[model samples]
Target: DFFWFNPSRLPSPAEWVNVRRIRVKDAVDPLWWMSKSAYPKANNRRVLEKYSDSMIQLIQNGYKAKLRPSGWDISTKFQKDNGGAIPPNLLQIANTESNSWYLRECARSGVRPHPARYPSRIPKFFIEFLTDPGDVVLDPFAGSNVTGEAAEATQRHWIAVELRVDYLIGSKFRFIRPHPVLAVPAG
Candidate 1:
């Protein structure tokens, strides 16, 4: 993530904040055993660039992957209805370093903001990539239940647990309708 955002700071970047996002998923379904690395992205550009500097540099220089793997050998071996999506390991999210968005959302919904919370995109990305409709997503260490919001938005069942009831209650803002004062007028 760091390398992708700041390619100029290569070799050894001082960035370490994004390293905290570690997700583990279990594909208990027997059919998904063979495609182990299919959804769970193992590494980011930081690690990949370190492992293969020249290879990643080629893309950094200008090269881009084929929009779809069609006509490629891999496409022949494996294919899915969502094959058009080229899953990228490197994530580029802006304004996630702060909970400003969450705070604003809380105000709009007339609720308090949790002191600490992750962006909904974090869980939304993983949930969309790893699970299908109606799957259950569990956030064992749910801070403000952002994962639960993402799961609910994606039409999945979710269970979120937090040490404090206040924080869990604050997460309800994610589901509450925005106040009329904050709603934008139709153009």
Candidate 2:
């Protein structure tokens, strides 16, 4: 995949007539879908069918079709609050360590290294939704660089930024090439 923030490009779903948007943001969270909504998993179904059919076609036609969404808009405001939601007490945790550590370790060893992959489909959907082939997609806090991988998989250019050196160095997957990072501009 091409990893670039400013120079490269991503893809737009307009390329495929099959992909369409039927509704706007859900009422509960303008940015997310309400689980109780009738079409809560609308995009998911379409994505699955598209990928499944494409996989089958690739096996028979000797060519693979890359499917991406029409737009790429990631918002962090709508996430559910985890402050008081977590269980009051668990088997682990000392007064010195933050609660996040337990969850982090659980995530690391449970299934995938990054238990929270943020769903590859989400980035793939965004890359497809907001851009066109070769268009550049920039992700400033690209945790795990999933966006970069999704962009590359969709043939779009991707650029990612992450301040945590350990996440970058210890990542199990390499979706974006590492460049010498410079300091952020001072205000």
Candidate 3:
């Protein structure tokens, strides 16, 4: 609705595979998980239970616990005191965005930074989130095959499909060294 040039059209959008169980030791811990802390929320369950064991606990105990403004602890803001890991934005006090969060990474010169293709981090986030090592990720509309590169980076197997041969050919650059030098024929 806010497009200035293409006012009639739209602008967009990861690479998430369907959910699966975690059976491998190498399952991804997520960038956020790695960046901050993971185990901190464990004590939250105990805190809620400590309020009391009766249906009338809130009425009886005077509500010792408090919920965040949104009242959904999963997107939590409660104080967890069990020495667990801090949340994703735990360290960075200033970077919180008001609307939403997006993961971004530098793209290769040509394969992405374009409307048609996506940054590898887009695929990287999902590959790490939904699957483990050796899990298979399939991108039906591969575009420049960013998902394939992300899969390889995350140690997951990947399958890509792009109807255009030129895209497929260009996609190969993703696997190559960032910059390569080829020799010129002798004149």
Candidate 4:
């Protein structure tokens, strides 16, 4: 779900694969919109604006929409006595974390950090919202296994696959005691 190119360079809707027609049972029904966080860069403003507009259009087109605060707002006067709020389509999480445990471990081990490692909050948010405990979570392109770590913390079984050996090695540091079955064998 990560896109490396700039928003302006994104593929047009016509050029992209249409998976909307695919049917799934209730067991694995995906949310109407997949939530994502983006870095607040000046160059990305136009793209983000357009994306937001499209999301609004989708809602107008009969897609269910819900808005949730990214996290707790201590100063807010309104309080919900029930469950946590529903997450919004546009996630406002900051992606910067130069001093995280993963980064520190990578630094201590002399391993290069994944350039595009997203904040754990991003995955944790969606996982909590869309899935229940004990559900299986899969991250096919797990760069540093942030999603795996979040899933494990939330009591969910997880599978993380990485293409690069170096990144896979560094990702192991995220776990306190690596599970034998999940470990990548040395070549």
Compose the digit string of candidate 2's lDDT tens values, residues 1-187.
Answer: 1221211112233434225644332212012222344543233222322234544444445532333375534233213232222211111211222233333543654523433334455567556645677977888777667678788888989877888765554343443333447545559
Candidate 1 residue-wise lDDT, 1-187, digit = tens: 2112322222222233234434322211111111244565332221222324544445345444454656644322232222133435554443244445556776766776776454566567667766676977878777778888899988999988778776777776667766879997989
lDDT of 3 by residue, 105-141 (tens): 2232333322455445446655665567797788888
Displacement of residue 144 (Cα, Å) in model 3 is 0.8
Query: In candidate 4, where is summed lDDT lowest over 10 consecutive residues?
Result: 40-49
Which has the higher lDDT value, candidate number 1 or candidate number 3?
1
Mark the 10 consecutive residues where model 2 has the least summed lDDT. Answer: 86-95
Q: Quote the positional error of residue 41 for candidate 3 in Å.
A: 21
Question: Which scores greater on TM-score, model 1 or model 2?
Answer: 1
- Please provide, for model 4 over 1-187, each residue's C-alpha lDDT reduced to its tens digit, 9 standing for 90 to 100: 2222222222234233234534322211122324243432112221222334444444445433334477644332232221223333555555557887778888988999888776686677656755678977778788989999999998888999999999998898788665779888999
Off by over 4 Å in 3: 1-64, 67-77, 81-115, 178-187
Each candidate structure's TM-score, on Cα atoms with residue i matched to residue i, is 0.48, 0.35, 0.42, 0.51
- Considering every candidate listed, which one attains the maximal lDDT? 4
In candidate 1, position 17 carries an lDDT of 26
